[model samples]
Target: MWVPAKFRSKVLAEPVRRPQLIEHSSDKNKNKNLETRPQQHPILSAQQHSISQELHGKKPAVFKMPVDYSKWDALELSDDSDVEVHPNVDKRSFIRAKQNQIHQQRFERKNKIETYKYERVVNDGLLKRINALLAALESHSADADKRSPDELMFMAIMETAGDSPNEAPPPPPAGVHTQEKEQPTYSKMMAALVDQVKAKVDEDKPENRFAAYVEDVKSHKAKVEDLQRQLLEELDSLEKEEGRKITSENIHTGFDSSHVTKGKAEDKSTGEAKKSTQKAQTVEVLNPQALGKPLLTKKSDGQQSSGADADADEPMGGDDDDEDEVEASELGKKFASIKAGDYRTCLEFISQHPEVVAEKETDGLLVLAFNSAIDGAYELARQCVHQALLLQYCRALGRDGVRMFFKRITTPGHQAQKVFFDDVNSTFARIKSRAKEIEKQRAQEEAEGTGGVEQIQLHAVDPNTTINIQIPPENSSDPAEIKAKELFNAFPPGLQRALESGSLDEVNKVLGKMSVEEAEEIVAQLSEGGMLSVEEQIIDATTEEGQKALKEFEEQEKAAQQEQAAEQAALSKYSDDPE
Candidate 1:
């Protein structure tokens, strides 16, 4: 068995009294004798070397040899040398050495690992202990300065009492109780609380007095409802009585309520008949125009024959020129003697033929003279005056005959040559000179006016209310609005300036200030004038926005159709080929 170096050393140090001598066997004796055998001569040595060369792994050296081989030659020279030969124990030693080396290396590795682990454990424990010490020191340092007497006392008491190893720790002092001392374990608190709750609940109960009060309030609410009903009835009766009074008061001098209703019925029937006939005639007229192709040839034999027959049936008692002159005179007379009965007839005539209106100048003022006044002649006259003003001042109308021509239709029987050509030429020069003086006066007034630029009404905000003339909503009509705008624009800046300066209180003080018939007559002339193109343009412009929109829409539709056709063509090719 192998022992550790230290133990072996200890055993060896206490030596045996006598050294033990190992006994040698006869094989070792034989080995010794063989090793001491006589040496061979050089030649023999060489020969032996040759023979053993294979075992020793070397080339044999050449040796010279005598020719005669004798027994003496065989005997080699010998030298007495004390030589020791150790036995070949290498194999046995190699196995044991390898095993011992492996064991030693394994032992060393295991011991080193165990030692390292042990050191790590020791280091960790040391570090933990150091941390604990540090924490304790910090806590002590923190508490050393701030501990109060009461805190210290408490700490000391706890330490003294708890630190006793022999006795059980004393029970802690009882916690402070929230309830008063009168509170008992049996807890009458619950019963007392119950009684208090019961009292509170009882207080909420309705008493006799409360019931009576509720009943009284209900009765009062009922009475209020009754009063409200009576008040509403009285209000309704008063409203009805007032309505009756209004109705009675609105009656005309001759007509009563019954007559008014009857008149209204008659008017409604007549109006309906007129409306239907008018619509039918309008449709007949418009249909051919819309088609843009004649419905029948103008020279058709059937129409010519019918026309001849109709003309032949008429009473041709008066000369044609004389009859025409009398008709015109009658129309003119109708205007001078305007009555409710003839009003409609005159208006229809004027509306149908608007070419006889006149333009005249008198007393330093332009006059638009109309031959007739249906209910709304004043309004039409104002419109014409406004247009003329715009033409004179703004220079926008540019000698357009459209305005004058429309006037002819609105004021039938007006003598054009006498009123326009004769009076206008004779009086225009005087009016122009006077107008220039008026312009200067107006500018002088405006410069002295109190209002500044901010207050000036340069443009009409509400076109309806801007005019001084009282044009009824119906009489003013579509054309009136356009005329008003034109005239408002035409006002000489000086006149407008005067008007803006507050001469608005009186018509004559501003636009009407020129002269009486001058302004009114100019308006009347325009209201009566007729221009076929003006009527057409008005109709056209009225529908311009919608027409433009519709044209664009139609163009889009055509383009869409074209695109669809192209797409269909391409798709059809694909369908036809199917490949």
Candidate 2:
């Protein structure tokens, strides 16, 4: 067969033959003969081998395939590549700029992660410290004599810090060590950090940032506790869900066929009894009167029987009665506990039994506790007011209850009680005076058909009017009046006009729209200006003049009682005479 040119060399080739022996000759002649012989090409030799294979009917020799290493040649080293840069820029500077940009990106990422971690650590430490201080305060453990000076200092700092963010700590308490004294390493580190931050921010040197931080933490305590409670509730719900899943899985997969067989057998044995028991239970649930009645069954003798069942039911009734009696006794004991003037115990009791604040039956006990707290030692009384929980108790007492409580303490009994009553009474007087003034203005406006609206005049004051109407001042020539004038001038023109209208209702409307602190400040100024005064003041019995006044008051009371008795006796005599 004729093969294509591509395969011609392999398909048609000369066959290998044995070399013939040469005759003996001189060395020069042999070398000349060897040189003169023609050389066979490689392609011709390969074709000769293939032809020999075809002729011999033997398989052609297989050659191993060569591996291409050109793919590896495409890879270029990063450093060896030439970079394109602007003609004006040096290659080294361009390379350095690229390196710096990459470095800056990595550095910023590292710094962000590090800062987050640091803040997390700081917040965790702060939370721990706040919880510790709150627990100490709540449990009254900080007052213990055995506590260290550092503990006392820490408590004082946290307690005495003002609500304002820029407020400083009060002076160190007696028996407490100064900041320079030895403290925990953590506290020292925090102090150092606070100092560094203050310095960097150019804050005042006298400000105590650490104390302010503590105060801020304390202010958000309720929110933190609420979050913790929510987290705990969520965790509990998740656990319950998991438990339900496990229970359902077990119900579906854990039981064996033998258990079903046992259940069926038991049902067969107790089916009639179960049906009768269910019927009785249904009757008891449907009929309210049937509650607590023993289930009676008809005996073979045709008589209904419930001998042991009735006996078994008696103890349940007795248990309920006993529980009611025990609860009543416990409530009575709590009420009686406040009669002793122990404010601490009273506060503890109120905390444990908050129902005292809400229950009408405990109103008397609540008042008694408050009176006892006021009558107790000065420090204890102050501490009672400072207790955060006490504010809730006071609010629960309502306005009337609070007024009565203050009235009871207003009596010249204890010096501390009187002092507290005076301060509270003054504030109450200011609020009441403002309320009364607003009411009076509203009444006048209603009478005049103005619908409680004070008409404002936009025109300027007339200087040439025939009637030289002098504006009567609220107070004249008194020191309080001078102070009031100064405060009035300081007010904005609109507010001054409202105040000048002499309709306190308008002033109240304006104040109502203001911030609470500003309103309070205005009210305080009004009070200091003698515009709000207590309608009544109790005489101080500790003074000599008060003692004489008391005797005169007693004589007057005796004379009035005698007159009242004489009138009653005369009326009784007339009635006895049937006239």
Candidate 3:
């Protein structure tokens, strides 16, 4: 039949699946897109130009448009059903057709393989035997799901031999024994199962899981309720103990009803201890040591207490027995700290409560006096305890605290009492003098700083050492010079020469030969005569005091050296410049 070109054009036109919309902005934009098709990519043009240059050494024409093979292919294969082709579709070729066509050759080559395989199976009777065995196994096969690995394998073997019970395997050739090979089927199946599952039977009880969860929840709730009750009871008891009265009505008033337990809470510390504040009148001080510090303390001096006529013998805080223990401990610490020369801490304690200075110290004089004498801080201890005596004095005693303290020391019946008192007067005088000298030196050092004249280290006031009380020689015929000459004449010839030459070690040796009193009298005479130098303090360099003194001396020497060098440098510079 001959078709009109108009009819053919209408038939070949794209089929209209949807109705057209009225021409709006979007429709106009769609029409504009149909006006022109873009050219092949410019990058492809550049690539072809570069390729041409690389081959022919020059740029060539722009890339020619690639022909669309889709429509052509569809047209060519339209009636050829045998050729599998995509209609009206374009597909890009990733790989070019293989020139050798090995795939088709390989396919044709498998034809002889199948034939040979069939012949081999038939010749060996493998296929027939396998099929017959399979039929027999299927007839007697157990359910696949219930069969174990061994049972299944045994069935397989039985089926292969037609269920022969008495057929035994032939003995292995002399040295060649048969061994079982691994079964890949079990391994693959187990691997698959392992991947899909996790072993968690403890948590995975299938039947009682929900019941266990319910029981656990009930137990937890009970535990929480019990804990809540305990907390509430504790809080109630604590409130009562702390002086906040707990009445029946207000027992659980502060706690939330929702969280409150039905039973009482156990107490912390005492199985429901009440607030300790209830015993407010008891005055429970944790450390009476601190309490004693604020009550009555004294400085280490013979200084009179402000309350000398007051009851200084009795312990403070007498309202309780703990006061006695506390006072003793405080006094003990004070004595130790003072003996150790830790005046800083003693001053701090006084600063906290200055009123402690006028409080009871101790009743016995021998205690403070003996301790002071033994600890090598005789003057300081005596002074402190004397002050304490004044503070601890009873108004009814009708006497000075110091006098009363002395009376206690010199009581006739006890020999030990005399021992403590006998040395007090003599030791006091020397220590007082030495203390004055030390105080003067310390004050001068503080006032002058490092720029002051060299310091004189004072020897400790003891029986063995000499006390240098050098007085300035007045008019060369001074009393000091006369006294020194007399002392010199009195000494042995060896001592006289050693003294004249200022050999301190020789003088010490000479002193050691005489009794302490005789040595002291001679040294005193020499000292009053202005014989000793300022720098000759007996220093054991191995001792801490000696080390400190040596260090100071070294620093002073270095300073002097620096000053001299500076002066020399100034003089040299002046000479060089004439300025």
Highest lDDT among the candidates is held by which one? 2
Q: Residues 1-579, candidate 3, lDDT per residue (tens digit)?
A: 777988988876956442233447757855775335322333457565466444543334555888786643322111222443365542222112231243443344344344333333322333233344345435444454465433543454455565333233233232232243332232233233222222222356545332333333344335445655565565455444433322223345465546532222332333233334334334443234423322222223332211111123322221233233213333333533453234345444444433344434443333454445445576665665543443344222333443454455446677634554445455455545565676677678788884332222224443224444343343467665766665554444444545655556656655554444445555666666667644445657999987887787678779889999999999887796755
Q: Order of candidates by TM-score, top first?
A: 2, 3, 1
Specify the poorest-scoring 10-residue window by lDDT in model 2.
317-326
The worst-scoring run of ten residues by lDDT in candidate 3 lies at 302-311
Per-candidate TM vs. native?
0.13, 0.16, 0.15
> Please, what are the lDDT tens digits per residue for candidate 1 over residues 274-350?
66775554322211221221211122112321111112332111111221111222223333233322434544444
Better of 1 and 3 by TM-score: 3
* Residue 538 alpha-carbon offset, candidate 3, angstroms: 51
Model 2 CA lDDT for position 47:
64
Error of 2 at 513 (Å): 99
Q: Which ten residues in a row have the lowest lDDT in candidate 1?
A: 530-539
Q: What's the residue-level lDDT of 492 in candidate 2? A: 40
Q: How many collisions per candidate? A: 33, 0, 17
- Positional deviation of residue 554's Cα in model 1 after best superposition, in angstroms: 70
